[model samples]
Target chain A: MELSQAARLDQAAEVLPAALRRRVLALPAAERARIEELRLRGGRPMFLLGPEGETPLPGTEITAQTLETVLEMASRSSVHTVLDQVRNGFVTIPGGHRLGLCGTAVMDGKTLVNLRGISSLCLRVARQFPGLASEVLPKLWQDGRLESTLILSPPGAGKTTLLRDLIRCLASGLGCPPLRVGLADERGEVAAMAGGVPMLDVGQRCDVMDGCPKAVGMAALLRGMDPQVLAVDEITAPEDVQAMLQAAGCGVRLLATAHGETLADLDRRPLYRSLMADGLFDRLVLIQQTDAGRRYTVTDGEGRPC
Target chain B: MLKLLGGLLIMAGALWCGVSAVERLRRRVRVLEDLRASLVWLSEELTFRRSPLPKLLEQLARERSGPVELFYREALAGLSQDPEGGLQQSWRRAMVLQLDFLREEERQVLVEVGKTLGRYDAGAQAQVLAQAARRLETIRAQAGEEARGLGRVYTALSLAAGAALVLMLL
Candidate 1:
């Protein structure tokens, strides 16, 4: 069975050093469910970043050894195996929980070779909201074909969570005809793949290229996987836009996410503006975190509010 | 008849003691050689394939045998049993428990290998494993030499001790 949010929090905590794990797990189930991230810094009190605010766990001072042990346990004692991710300053655990690391950088001629002497770890618990795309999915289709769509949100606004559900729904044919989705999961966050199998359910027809750079994986997926849709997270690089444009040229629809609160916000960035000028995406879903809950707004390519 | 039987028993006991002494020396040499071979294989795998430590240890346990196999199996078991203690603790524990035949110096080489196995990048780990294999090779060479020399001495000493006892008794 898939784990509940609180259970996932507990599962992520399992990788923490023993004492910290116990302290984090001791929270009320309600509080555990609300936690978004866990921050542990050497010589500082550990804090749980929840929806409310940063809640510090008093008297729990993190040490360098604690950070090392957590990394060791999280990597299953194979830090060498995940050195590529370590070089990127974060390591994603099996269940898609991401551990953002802070440490002294080991460099090789302007390149980050690895991270050593870790001082802090921010563990972001990955949650699956399977039905989050239900309302947003119907609006993305025009006639029999799905439109190229882009999900927009500020960081920590559940953009990845929504993208994951959208892919699952599209591939599973929950609300639309099932399409083969080629996911370029650069950091392994979208699929949380382990040994060629996704730890999280992406869908029956989803083909994930895990831990590959978005631009390269998308091109490879387009060439080999014959995907009808290419879904990528965080369109941050120019190479990623070029790849997406190439895929769109082949009539393969795209489902991608970008860091933005609104369509206007995306237009301010030269990279996003150029992609928009190409008319690559026909639909945009902007996610806003509200007092009540998260609000999803679907807009046309022209930025007309729905 | 009783005296003849006692003499026979003395000779048989002496032969058994001599054989056992020779076997212990041979076993030590065999163990060291096997361990060195396993480390070499591990180093290659880490450098080329970059397989995870647990999976590699599992493969080592499955394909190998004797003290080398036992050592890997115990280390793998340690990881599963008490993961919070991490690989270093598990590896050190496994070495202390399973590598009793190794000299203090030989075991110390393994202990150093344990400390670096999973803590660094593939290049670093591969280098450490290669160094360990070299150290083990040196130790095994010395052990092989000693086994050839000391093995005969131990057998001969046991044989002489047994003969003298039998002579006194007779």
Candidate 2:
């Protein structure tokens, strides 16, 4: 079978330095296709993380020089264009590939402005598995409309992947009335936008506002786009919860994700605690990576199984 | 007829040597001037825009349009081929290869500029670029002074030598 345009191997290989690229290219074809991330740290062995967990790339040692080369290639030699993302600790390269950065913080009057002495990097492959949300969508929608929904999952459990599919399905009106979806992509993940263009299929009716804070983008979409459903990822900040509440108050449907395994975990966070008690969300979907793909459990706002 | 041909040949040989010597000095001056202008523009760009290194290098390659462009273009190509060498190493290799006419001091200053490039905040990078530009300005002045004297001497000496050779042949 031919490779899809989005997953063309060259895009993934571009971020790697010469030594690492050779190492990655030598992996079996199936293992190469399943690669989700390539993690590099100065003075440590390289690692490849996929669905099968982390596998170390032995005989490879990341160095300060290796990181400099990756930055040069990934940022296209322009540090200014990605300075904001650097300050935020990650950058989204072309082809919708996201690179996470870790280095010494450069402070501008107590606020983190950028990084220096960068020593660790994570190059994540942006893969879209369409229709992953098929089974979970019916639970999110009830009586022919999307309820204010929240998805919960642990880190690396495919929360963003599921969210992307869910947004596409709902916006395409899987079996219901077609509705406009406003995706406030804070970290450029949901839509994986590059040059203001959406790389992943978020659906025909989805309008995205990316590369800004989720709260700010959400508020902007709510005021300007007048979307029927607003989606955001990883709502950990109090400001994001405020924007989500404001969207709920405006009677717009909410679709969002948070870092947690169970509804009980979300109940512990103050921000989510208020959101839960106020009934801002009507449905909760929890995801766990299972042997047979991902397993999702559904419940109502009051913690009752759907 | 044979004597006349010998005289013309001697004059031609003298003219070629003299002109080639003068041209070499003049070319060095042009190189220094072009590099200085490019550095000034780079400083301004680094101050205002603070673009990423690869992007800025591509832009410089396009805008500078000569040996200056060669430096960036070669650096980009080298980085693509051997990224494990680091950005500084790639850039240094370009500078050494492309800026062969440059004095060791002038080349050293350019390599220093690479140290802070793409590795610091805008203010810091701009500061480094500005300093490099200043150093390049001084080197350009030094090259200009040397080129003016040497160019005139080589051209005058060659013309005189050609005339003497022609007279001797006659």
Candidate 1 lDDT over B1-170, as tens digits, reads: 99778878887898788888788878888888888899899889988999889999999999999888999999999998888888899999999899876788988898999999898878888898899989888888888888889888887887788788878998
Model 2 stretches astray by more than 4 angstroms: A1-14, A33-52, A55-124, A173-176, A220-226, A249-251, A290-293, B1-23, B44-48
Tens digit per residue, CA lDDT, model 2, B19-132? 787777777777777777766776777778665566667787888767877988998788667655656788899988898877789888888887767666677777877788
Alpha-carbon shift of residue A152 in model 2 (angstroms): 1.3
Instruction: Quote the lDDT for A271 in model 1.
Output: 97
DockQ in order: 0.76, 0.37
> In candidate 1, what are the lDDT values of residues A129-232, reduced to their tens digit?
88999999999988888999999999889999999999999999998899999999998998888788987778889999976789999999998999999999
DockQ leader? 1
Top lDDT prediction, candidate number:
1
- Residue A184's lDDT within candidate 2 is 96
What is the lDDT for A305 in model 2? 84
Candidate 1 segments exceeding 4 Å error: none
Please state the CAPRI-style docking class of candidate 1: medium
